[model samples]
Target: MTPTQATAARRSKISPERAQELYAAVLDELREHGYEALTMEGVAARACCGKSTLYRQWRTKPQLVAAALRAHRRGTLAAVDTGTLAGDLREAARIAAGTSGRDTRLTQALGLAVLSDEELQAALREALVEPELAAFGAMVQRAADRGEIAAGHPALEFLPAQLMGVLRIRPVLEGRYADAAYMERFVDASVLPALGLAPAP
Candidate 1:
């Protein structure tokens, strides 16, 4: 079909606001009921729409879940410019912690579902992981361009890993939360020194 025809077909599916409403309802359903129990019928009923409506938007369960993830992709790291590299790194760490904290339960469900399904894993990565990585890559690239770090610096690729590491390990390691204070300290003590960027004078 032509581009215009494709556009028309998509428009006929659902309005943007309605699609967002459906996506939000689907995510809530996934959160309350594990992905194993999540069904398009249930999502349709919850969203007060019809099964055909759900099908029109997303033909498969993974596709529907993927759309839900994409629709609600505002996981922290939205606004993270603090002038100094140390400041930006601190905010970046907090953003990582905040994003996980905000969506941990739901993502846990997604994780469970992906463990048993390959298609779901691919869908999840494309829908959620890729976008997040893309956003972070852009920031890291900008930092490099700003001469904060050399392009080939080992620390560049390690930044996201550090952010994720702290979030993933805090509760398990210290039996404590990775709060903003902890995130800030991680930047000050560990992240900054690693990047060769000393703390503010």
Candidate 2:
């Protein structure tokens, strides 16, 4: 079977009950201990399951963390319904920045872990970055279909970075709220125009 199908099969083998339990335990461990300290042993201990069970499914801590990220993927990208590019992007930025803001701990921790391991970085991108960007890309495509932006817009794929970057840097640079409103202003001033939308008010 293909890799994804194999993953699906293994996931299916995991009783929904046990799967959620394992995932929850792992996330809690991440929240408390940070990524480097998060181990399969730790997760299995907290999950009250054997380490083999986690290893059978994930093989490594990076894989386990990557899966956990997939399980908890959320924010504006998850429910974007705005018909207009500007509106959609504003919400997208607001949501994308979420992980970098109050939930900043996880993002920061992941950043450190990824930098230390190229393989883990790839897996992290697959689990975290690619999915979110793909979701946002669909919105960008829809905007192009509506003539709000160019499909050929060079900055299209970089939308995720633009949205998340500001938030990650805001605390370091300005020490302010990168809230929905802040994200909105971002959409109006920088992102929208970059995608060829009209400048913000």
Candidate 3:
């Protein structure tokens, strides 16, 4: 379609506020039914919009859900500066444990599907993984600058894997979501020792 036609089409449909409301429905559907089982019709029904509206906005379920994911993306760990690497890591662990349980479930739900679906994988990376990775990298770099860790410390290098691994696995292992207290314990018992540092005094 022509640019004017596209603009007209978009203008004729839902408001941005309305679209935001619909995106919530999309995510809820994804959480409830998973990616493979989610349908455009289901999202529309939940959003109380016409299926044609969604189809007009996004030609396929993947595109619509990708948009929803992007719309819902937020800063996962954008403001975590605790003055010391150990302090920061402990704080990070706490944040991850509290916030990541649902994300872990979502990732598990999308597991093998993400591997085979390029669009879905890209959406997942952009919406979920990249922000947290950037935050973790910045946290580590700040720690190095502050002399909390060696520039080439092994723990610094492996920190992301360690934290993310525990976040993903804890639910499976114990049939319980990791919580702040559990994360603090993990930091004290494991992360601090790996970094060759004692817990904060």
> Which candidate has the top score in lDDT?
3
Of 2 and 3, which scores higher on lDDT? 3
Number of clashes recorded per candidate: 0, 0, 0
Instruction: Write one digit per residue (lDDT tens) for candidate 2, span 100-171.
Output: 553565666665777888878877787777777787878877877888777887888778777778877777
Q: Which candidate wins on TM-score?
A: 2
Give me the runs in candidate 2 sitting further than 4 Å from their true place: 76-79, 97-102, 199-201
How big is the positional error of residue 2 in model 3, measured in Å on the Cα after superposition? Answer: 21
lDDT of 2 at 123: 77
The TM-score that candidate 2 achieves is: 0.84
Question: Model 1: per-residue lDDT, tens digit, 130-196?
Answer: 7667766767677777888777778767777777677767766777667777888888898889889
Global lDDT of model 3 = 0.78
Q: For model 1, state the Cα shift of residue 45 in Å.
A: 1.6
Candidate 3's residue-wise lDDT over 93-170, tens digit each?
A: 877876667567766766577889997776667556677789888888897888878878866777788888887788
Worst 10 residues of 3 by lDDT: 3-12
Candidates arranged by TM-score, highest first = 2, 3, 1
